[model samples]
Target: MPQAAKRSNDVPGTAPNLVHPAVVNDDAVRTALAQHMSRISGSRTEITSFGRKSSGFSWITYAFAARSALGGDRKLILRVGPPSGLFAPYSVLPQVHALQALAGSGVPVPALVSSAQDGAEIGFPFFICEHIEGDVPAPWAASELDPNHKRVIARQFIEILASLHRINPDATPFASQAQGADRAELRAITGWRASLARPTARYYPLLDWGGRWLEDHCPLPPCRTVVHGDFRIGNFIEHKGRIVAILDWELTHLGDPHEDLAWAMMPTFNARSRKLYGVLERAEVIELYQRASGIAVSDRSLAFYEAYALYQAAAIQMCAVRAFEVDRFNDMRLAVMASQMPSIVRAFERALEAAA
Candidate 1:
């Protein structure tokens, strides 16, 4: 939950001071945001509280409480893609289109308020959405869940994923990437491998080996659908063992459905309980997804994607390393990602050895 900043004198356009230590240049952000909200809503708006929510390397999130004459009081989330973020030159359109299309589709997602591709709004590509109240359980903390609650969450997790993959790709921006199974696999490999060039121009032997192995073992996907590229335990909000909303659609795209299954099965995410996400085993995930989607799961395809998942995870860590070293991103979480590289390499190596 985001805490409200202590109030003081008002900024020029804002109703009151909305300053937080984590927010850089709080005055400027408050004034600009107030003006933008007023113009969009056609009423005077005031941001009463603003606080940074997550230190994620890709996009900046802020949870704020606001009030206006037209609309009483409400909580909303502001997501911005800054120039120095890991994935630079970002656009929020893909996320916007997907959320719009998924409404009432049985998948829990926050309501989209507004979005802009151009940086004119907040000096960056950004969007605002109605805030959902829930707690995000860290991957390692999965063991702490109550036994009954864990069972309920595990069922919801796979069911929601199956529902997402059943949506028509043509209705969303991801249709451009829904070429085929081969293209989807190759696109991910090529893009992530290219990202390795930015972090000091150094060679990564394990990543190179894993990438090559993925290409050699690529399997035809069971079905190509919309893949929630980051659909793991920690990304969803849960309240009373029920998922209220699935967060972080930045990496969502059209690809092999198994890619998400493989990501959820990663051992790094199952640290404490040793089960996938500390609730289900590998076989259980495949069985549940197959029953729900009616798409058979191929063990070979899952194996191939598991390797690709590890490779992609390593590449993303490299992005964080570059953000910290070269872009001078202040989030220490990015710096910590540098230390997790070795563990990823070891996991990649083990996956290959077992597959062999």
Candidate 2:
């Protein structure tokens, strides 16, 4: 099994450098993980190598190789949501349940090993899964990518999204969370608005107008589908000219499929290339999505979702600002996000004007 590379300081016999609070007490975490694995597997298990990895903002992930008498040696990923994350008070059950349902359902996801919802086992709610090999392609690159390569990845992207939306929410764990499409939209807007209403949240006038517009023009959904809440260019892993896996399901929920499509088409993800995600044109995306999803998409409905996406994005930034300034998270990423608020508001204004 391939072991996750450890920093020189992380190696035994070296003076360990400081780690994020989320992953502090590495020795304690390793011991706890091994013990948990043993109890679950009915055999003694050992964590041979452990390395904390920097990945998503919400979940703290670590890559490790484990050896057990029953399960042998395996490379795996451990993901835990910290209280200090941008979106705090997370439950791993939703992510774990969605992953279990998607596995072997034609959507590529890491195989679930085991999951727990509280800190009693691993010092935090977490889940373990098989470590898959792939490279993440960042969305902010300025270098020109080959057109053919972009097309192949784009095709895979839309097809996977279509497959995800085709899933029956009633048959999955999300069944309990399901609601009418209109209710889903209202709930999302209400939740974000609540975040913005927080005393710690930064003020943005455009957001007020944007929120009103969203409520005034909310569209009826064609049907409810499992929406990948943060579906976008940077959320997937691409290897060998194809997307190997769609990552980061923290925001997965039962909602309108167009919500995911609109998020993926956000201008920020386009790298200023004036193309959707800097890959497909707007019409091209709609055509491909409709053909693959077997669901008709209207221009008005898409426009409404596009606006809602911007509103939700600005609200997320506000949450980040609060996390950095009021919550006092030690992560500098949250501070940087605070600095980007101006650009976010500007984007919100442009989107609103376009909609007008």
Candidate 3:
């Protein structure tokens, strides 16, 4: 196992020294990356930030400018796994495969450029892909974006999810590698139960109760479809008043589509706009999804998954904080993200009570 890097509580939004050209000094990795980019874009490429950090979770994201041979420059984002390895089982390749599978399916995702599982190139697995150009509105933007834009983006978000839920995992190239299951409820409860076993400042009885309730009251099975594990406004790029790219596939899997719905509707991600869960009314989002997917949104099912989403998020945040406490926080993003758990738990409690 690679040794973990020290944790740094660096303030968010402070761009690291990633833009300096010499930062990518590894000869072999640079050669390979340039070759890969050339193959993809037919360009003489420069890999500027191999070791520097960019965004999202604990991974090292390198943003590079690709000047293609034919003309035009394109910005690309590369996500390299942390040296200490990821906390989740899903790898970069699986995410790439998922994106590729979703192509032409009416779901907007950043186009995947290339993916590799080999650790030799960058000390860990990494994937390179196109960067969607748009601003991720601050949590405050929940109320800031024009109400009509908000509604359009909100409706698009839910409708795209409906399309994602319709994807047939078995028909995709990743079928053999992707775990097959209609056991969305079972796996979600069991997975979170295991995560909750880890040390935390306080054990949440609500989580335990929620897990049991989900197990006992598993909703009627819907058509199996893809679930964007971390479906939320923060994970998407809204451009020209519409969601152009759905970002972050690390938590994606095939399961109950409602899992995505509940996660998106979770109040924690509501970003302070109480009127809209994540900037759009819950009824509006559900109605949009129902209209697009032609599947009815069940009140009971949504309520159950809402509780499950909260419990799962709380458990995951505890694990994140624990990792930081253990001094294993290589990525400052994860460390600070862990610190937000108290607020998250409070939101979870509120959602749970609302469901009750």
- Which model is ahead, 2 or 3, in terms of TM-score? 2
**Cα lDDT tens digits for candidate 2, 1-356:** 11111223456877655434344356777889999888888999999999788745677889999999888999999887765566767799877987898999867888899998876678788999988888776777724677678778877998899989888878888877665334767877878877888876467777876787787777777988888888888788888987878888877888778899988888787686656657688888888989999989877777778878878878887776676676555567667888888877887787666666
Cα misplacement distance, residue 92 of candidate 1 (Å): 1.0
- Candidate 3: deviation at residue 146, Å? 2.3
lDDT of 2 at 12: 80
Off by over 4 Å in 1: 1-24, 176-182, 199-202, 325-332
Candidate 3, residues 147-243, lDDT tens digits: the string is 7777677777787888887677678755565455446558767877787776655566766776666677777656666778888877788777877
Quick one: ranking by lDDT, best first?
2, 1, 3
Off by over 4 Å in 2: 1-24, 142-144, 179-182
Cα lDDT tens digits for candidate 1, 287-315: 89899987788777777777788888898
Error of 2 at 125 (Å): 1.2
Q: Which stretches of candidate 3 lie over 4 Å from their true place?
A: 1-32, 35-45, 48-55, 67-74, 85-90, 174-185, 277-279, 327-356
User: Model 3: which ten-residue window has the lowest total lDDT?
Assistant: 16-25
Whole-model Cα lDDT of every candidate shown, in order:
0.77, 0.78, 0.68
lDDT of 2: 0.78
Residue 346 C-alpha lDDT in model 2 = 85
Indicate which candidate wins on lDDT: 2
TM-score for candidate 3: 0.79
lDDT value, residue 26 of candidate 1: 48
